[model samples]
Target: MSIAICIAAACLGAVLLLPACALARSATAAPASGIPATGVIGIEEGQLNADYWIRQQSKPDATILDPRAIAAQNKRLHELDASVHDIEHLPARLTRAQVREWIEAMSQPREETLYDERGEEIPAATLAALGDNLALDTIPAEQATRYGMVVRRADLRTFPTRLRVFNAKGDSDIDRFQESALFPGTPVAIVHASKDGKYWFVVSPLYAAWVEKDRIAEGAKAAIFDYTRKTPYLVVTGASARTVHTPEQPGVSDVQLEMGVRVPLLADWPSDKPVNGQHHYASHVIELPYRDDQGRLQFSPALLPRAADTSADYLPLTQANLVRQGFKFFGERYGWGHSYNTRDCSGFVSEIYRSFGVQLPRNTRDQAVSPAYNRIDLAEGLSHEERLKIVKTLEVGDLIYIPGHVMMVVGHEDGWPYVIHDTTGITFRDRTGELARVHLNGVSVTPLVPLLFNREQPTVDRITSIQRIRP
Candidate 1:
């Protein structure tokens, strides 16, 4: 007879850490259903499916200017935590939470705040507040003022309209500007926006004022805001060209450029943007955008051709067994062109459906607009009843999308809807358990939302529409 194998490390460790004979009690604890012993966790395993499990070995501490360094620090913390957990099993009588506390204390390092341009660290209070699950959109006004990062040119997208630039860094005050007056695709910075949907910006140093809600993309990722703290005054010359350069050094005074395109600084240059002619000068200028080892302007394949799956069966109802098969390929680091290392959005969808013998389109937009086996035209819009009818008509394994994206609604896990899609990797987002957007580099699966599904210019926002396809 075959044995249903179970790994005892997670349970045994938990039991031994409790106390004498406490092992017996902990040993009797069966993990919640559907949760397999992943060696790191013993609880119902379904909870472990969240796209990156960040174990808080240390107590939440300060805000970091460069959060990138945390990964290196976390490695040491994990090692120390293992040692702490090793001793807790001595029958010393501790609650489970207590055991976890001690383990965390040993594993995590004390939080440290990173300093700003002035060489002073942000306040501990500010760091602690940042630790809270604060939505990017609901930032408190006081904190916004205190931590306000000033950037020159930021890209903003108005819902259902073309993306435009707003001059958030006004040459003067911002009380005199008008939203309607702001030019499309013009760069702007965030001075202030209220939860009530009212806000103000500086179109130029001389112009500033309130803009309507429809004028700004709510909670959009502010690229310029991120750069201002590090590299200030990065100017670009070619207004119509795709490639631009960055200043070599920080705090360099602006150089005279051209018009129809302000030589003004641009922020959040794409990973693939050209760097030639971009120079940085703290006091003196230095050329950059160096050639690669092969003597070519550095280039990497950011997007691949979209392919469609051509498998035979694609219905979840006909393939119910996949519900229990979690894409357990977690803890993998991200890599470009290497889907095996980290899953991209289209890569995840294509591979998963392939496993089930269902062919799917390889790119988000293509998959979203593929010859549907149903179509939901958002242009005409639909009532709740109509929407439900359309949704109800969907078969298991049928894909749902916004404009140029796709998501697979799987069987419920622990009373919540589980969706499988490609994020930076194959990650899961748990909203109401049922509805979640595929968030990768700030893009998701919600319809009517603007997405960077296609990298080509001019035709970028053209989603066309959404489609539902199944075999």
Candidate 2:
């Protein structure tokens, strides 16, 4: 029987057992009031399980795209998307004008009023100092491009400073300076540096932003790319994993590896040898990036426990695997620009698909408009009913874009489509038709139809596009 029908039958039995007076009192009880204690609405208890959604798929195990197909799609993305860069193929030298353009583009003044952590408005002089810190005048007429690899997970900032700014007073969850993050061993081109010599303006495959100098190590382009291209790597399949804590090799010890991060495996290592004070038998030996005292790039062996959630290769792109991968991050805190050792909306979905060897743009705006994927662009003139019709047709793993946020379709229940997303909060119509707001502030699952983009519109009416990661 359907879930709705089962719920109706249970309610009927409960009503029949209640006393007449109790029933009369219950009838007048307050309308299905505030958001549930769990901060999730429209989700049945059973819907939380990956198996529940997997069972709903007609062909859960069917491959969405084979290895060759995924490779072709990635190549097409690198070619078509302006936001994605092919750093390995960049020119050896950069002109002053070229470097200036990159710096000026990202250093634009903010139109909105920004407040510091103390709730004080940022002074005009302070903003000007930040602009000066860009050191655009320092760019040489012709300079050799420097290459490097991220030695650790590092924050990508909008400006060279580490000052945190927010849109509103007392609201500090979203840091405007935080652009994105880079994983360990990710290759990059160091284009410029802050006047303070503290941060580098780097161009990574997915983003270009200011990263701390200590988190990256200067290296030869060939050596950096060679390390990234090494095969027989281990793919992180869990929400996150960490290397064994080691005082002997602190550079590679206790390092956090997020989902989809691939590290080259030391496949030929001797079985009897210990790695950083740990036995090789209990762990997988992997080569990790390290920064020397002189800030030069180096490699060291580290131990990733065999019990950690990892795979020898990318997981097969299948419907069941999509549900399983997404659920691995369920309830993780929403971290803007991958802050808090977690991820935001786009990062959440990108990492899940990355584990399957599929590549996507790093931000929602880029992913939604990219021509690399099959997309359904929703016109502003489309009626609400028309948009709902399109949403109902979305298959598992399809991405739904609504302005700044994106959600992955999990499954359908009682004719309503459910989605999983990392978000700050959700708004929906309560029993009395009054809009109720819930501060979810984390990865959550909710039905799509009842959600509100704001008090003025439903989420369906605000969808800008839907992207399908398929041929």
The most accurate candidate by TM-score is 2
- As a TM-score, model 2 comes out at 0.92
Best by lDDT: 2
After superposing candidate 2, which stretches have Cα over 4 Å from the reference? 1-31, 34-39
Can you give the lDDT of residue 284 in candidate 1? 21
Q: Could you estimate the TM-score for every candidate?
A: 0.26, 0.92
C-alpha lDDT (0 to 100) for residue 357 of candidate 2: 87
Model 2 worst lDDT window (10 residues): 1-10
Q: In candidate 2, list every pair of residues with a backbone clash.
A: none
Residues 379-416 of candidate 2: C-alpha lDDT, one tens digit per residue: 99999889878987889999988767788999997667
lDDT for every model? 0.28, 0.82
Each candidate's root-mean-square deviation in Å?
24.8, 7.9
Clash count (model 2, backbone only): 0
Candidate 1 Cα outliers beyond 4 Å, as residue runs: 1-318, 324-326, 330-340, 372-380, 392-395, 413-417, 424-471
